[model samples]
Target chain A: MPITTCVFDAYGTLFDVNAAAAQAADDPDFPRLADLWPAVARDWRRKQLEYTWLRAVADRHCDFWQVTQDGLDWALAAQGLDDPALRARLLALYRQLPTYAEVPAMLAALKARGLTTAILSNGSPDMLNAAVASAGIAPQLDAILSVETVGVFKPHARVYDLVGAQFGCAKDEVLFVSSNGWDAAGAAGYGFRTIWVNRAGDPPDRLYADPHHTLGNLVSIPDLL
Target chain B: MPITTCVFDAYGTLFDVNAAAAQAADDPDFPRLADLWPAVARDWRRKQLEYTWLRAVADRHCDFWQVTQDGLDWALAAQGLDDPALRARLLALYRQLPTYAEVPAMLAALKARGLTTAILSNGSPDMLNAAVASAGIAPQLDAILSVETVGVFKPHARVYDLVGAQFGCAKDEVLFVSSNGWDAAGAAGYGFRTIWVNRAGDPPDRLYADPHHTLGNLVSIPDLL
Candidate 1:
């Protein structure tokens, strides 16, 4: 079958996780955060994804919200700066992250082209909803999916199965997009056509199938087909 | 029944992965390697482990040797240094990488106490055999196990099953040891009594289960039980 639907990874793909750290600059409590935020954000996102995979492998499922908080706490401790206010503010920022400017336009363009577009993420339903609504991109998406329904994280086959189940389409007919190369590899290995948004220019993850398409940002996604 | 068998993760736990890159300091071609080797080794090991997990999740299993080489290649590219002879020499160094100072004595103590000892690692059979023989610790082990039998990497339940299957013991009757906190978590989650060798003073991986015992190195393993 020809491609009929597009599924995106929520965190790094559709939402900018580092944007939450930018809010730290306004907080006088974290004087060093302006310079440290980038590394902290990277560590937090790495731990978040790692926790999801660890929990899945251990047969212990926690919502992505808890994982996100745990990841933030780890990142803070690793950086050796502890402030209750800064912690709370950073987490609050996560609930409403900024998106790539091309996100809404791309989703709209996909819909306009008659392609069904949805998000397939390890994020919790509440987290996804708040992020989508806060970014003003909720109205443009056909569906907002979360791993909570299945109680496992992405890169797991069952997580990918949720997309086909939702849209009633074959795996190959659903186009998967993720900024995370590991997630892209997993989706492609699961039989979806994957577009890896390598915004950071990292090497391809060598453990899984390579993504079908590679692009720098969401600006190129609408024209990917 | 009480724990009867002790299994160890080979690469970082028993053998020093960094030792290979340190050998590069002896090479005339890479004179700047002394300071660069540690960071390069860290990146290489990180990518190697990530590939193992990603491969396991993607159902695209390859032997650990390939993963190790792929990881080293990526680390080299990231460092923007390319030399075929340097790569070959580094890989050759891996087959006889240095072991922890206390490993042989600890294994001897376990044997003298009439406890069974073995190695449960992601290493390929040849790599494990060569390392154990070179370290003069092969006679100390009753079994040399690999993930090849299970076709997956650690943290996957099946890989842990290889240990129990070889020893004909229940999961709880086996004690697993690893320097990697993530590996310890997987063993604990799989129902084995775990000892995390925290030689680097790193924080525990905030993933799932915690190890049953924590020690600075193999020097503490014999006294653990």
Candidate 2:
């Protein structure tokens, strides 16, 4: 089936998770702490995903901001780096993350092609909005939906339902793009047409849900659509 | 609040994931595909976790054996390694994984101390039984339970509930131990006295359900109990 609306996952898809960490690593002001930033970033991402899965199974809901902070705290302690100010700055950077180089141009292309572009993220509404606003790409979106409204994270069918409900389309009509393999598989399992943005060259998850398309980056998405 | 029972997570906690892959890597007989083994193992582990989470949320049930095979198949394709005999042999090795050096002695210590020891794992019943039997550790366990009966994976309260149900004790009387930080947090959150086996020095999850104790390895679990 032909795809109509295109929904993108926010983190690691549209935004670069390592950019802030890489920048921090290169900063002369914090030489000793520089070595720990990448590990910290990786742990933070791991914790975020772990929290989302745990909360979903526990039937608990918290805003992504809270989870992000919780993950950051764990990472900080794990890395044995306990500077509160540095921790605060790293988190602040997350809230105001820059979009991937291809995001704005790709969104523009999708819009020009008369396709609706939206963000279906695990991010909280405020987090997603602030990120889009800071990146100056809020105007490019037809809608910004978050798992917070549904009280569950992505890969949960109800979270995906929010998109179909809002757009008045079947799941298959939506082309969902995600840099996270599990998220792509989840959306595919939920019956959405899926594209996996293999940004890091990570292997595809070995589950039943296979992506309908795969690309190295979002830059190729517009052409595929 | 003393722990009267010590429950162990089966995979990775007692069994090494990399051992089989390492063996495969060193096989002169299969030199052409040996290097791909680690990636295959990593992807297989990743997919196994993904399937468990997805199936739990979907209210679906499949034995861990089924999920393990599915994961292995996906890993093979993702790595472009498609030897059926090699895949079968690797998986067969998984069924008879060697327990970590500390596992038997630690269980013996717990047994000598008159504390109950059990296998509370995400493995299917048959898989868990076969592994215990093959590892020659069956005599050490008071009971072996799997999430297969509950139709959900660990981090789900129902899976943890099996412990209390089987022992006729409150959750707090049992101390659940896992190398997986997320499982430790889940068991802690479900009200078990928890001990995290931090074999890899990974940080605690920001699960809000912190383990009561953390040890470098299972070598000290009996002392804690």
Candidate 3:
């Protein structure tokens, strides 16, 4: 099926998830993060994703913003950096994360080609709005779907259902892109033509389905279409 | 309600999850693991639980044994340990992992008090049977429940349902214990009195529910009753 809609996972895919910590580390005020930011970033992202999956399975639905804060708390504590000020700064930065260098143009090219584009994320609606507005890419997106509407997180069939519900596209007529191997695999299993943007060169997850294509970045996303 | 049944998570609770890697590291043949065993064990356990949660949310059910091996593969690759022999040896060690020093005594004490004792775990039946038998604690456990019977992994309500289904007890009548804070929290959400065996001194998970009690080890479990 020719792709009619392109759905992207927001956090790690369109927005650089590590940018908040990386940005905070650059600030002279947070001297502690200069060497510790990478670990904090890695653990924060890992715990955030883990919390979503746990909540999804446990039937404990919460907003991704709350989960993001919970994750940052765990990550900060894990690294023994217990400063509440640093925590607040990191979260503020997370709300307006910098998009990947190619996101705006690549998304624009897809729009120019008359293909529908949307973000299907575990993020809350407000968080997604802040991110889209901050990145100035709202015009490029036809819709921004969050898991909050369904009261569940990603990899759940319910979350994926929002895609076809919004676009009126068949499962096969969507190209789902994500930076997470598990999310891409989950989308693949849900029958979307999936692309795993493997930014970190990680190994493939041994999941139920394999992504149709893997790319190093989104610069080549327009080419794939 | 008084606790009539005592249910414990198998891996990392009754059984020492790190023992296999720690044992393998002591072997002269695997010189590489002497210093790296802790990282391998930590990553392996984290990925194992993460895969379970992912598969659970995605509705892609697989046996815990498969998830275990998949997790091991990810951990090994992360540590740059690519030896197939080492991989095989690790899997062999995992099948009969050592029980925590206090597990046998702890379970026996609960059984002596006329409380129904069992293990509720994501481990496949065969794997759970092997571990239980290997630990020589099979006599103390009235039932060994595995997620394979329900075709789902834990923190899912269905997996927890196995506990009451097997013993014909009310959710409140059961005392659920898990080494994982999220698991304990999940059981709490499921309406069972929960205890989080915080072996690692880790921070509390900011999940929907908190474990009713926290203990350093299973040794103090019987006293709680």
Which candidate leads in TM-score? 3
Task: Show model 3 residue runs off by greater than 4 Å.
Answer: none
Candidate 1: list runs displaced more than 4 Å. Answer: B1-3, B32-35, B170-173
- Model 1 docking category: medium
Clashes of 3: 0
Query: A1-225, model 2: which lDDT tens digit per residue?
Result: 678899999999999977766766676766756788888889788778878877888776788888999988888888788877777778878988888898899999999999988999989989998999999998789999999888987678899899888999878789999999888888888889999999777667756578888899988788887
Order of candidates by TM-score, top first?
3, 1, 2
Q: By TM-score, how accurate is candidate 1? A: 0.93
Arrange candidates, best lDDT first: 3, 1, 2
Clashing pairs for predicted structure model 3, backbone only: none
Tens digits of per-residue lDDT for model 1, B1-225: 688999999999999998999888777888767668887898899888777876765567899999999899888777765878878988999999989888889999999988999999999999999999999998899999998887878888888988878889888889999999889988998899999999988767787788998888888677767
Query: What is every candidate's alpha-carbon RMSD to the true fold?
Result: 2.1, 2.6, 1.7
Order of the predicted models by DockQ, top scorer first: 3, 2, 1
How does residue B79 of candidate 1 score in lDDT? 74
**DockQ, model 2, C-alpha based:** 0.52
Tens digits of per-residue lDDT, candidate 2, B1-225, equal 667888889998988876776676676766755778778888788778777877776555588898888888878788777788778777888888888998888898899998888988889988888889988988889999888788888788899999888888878788888888888888888888888888878766787678888888889877665
DockQ of each: 0.51, 0.52, 0.74
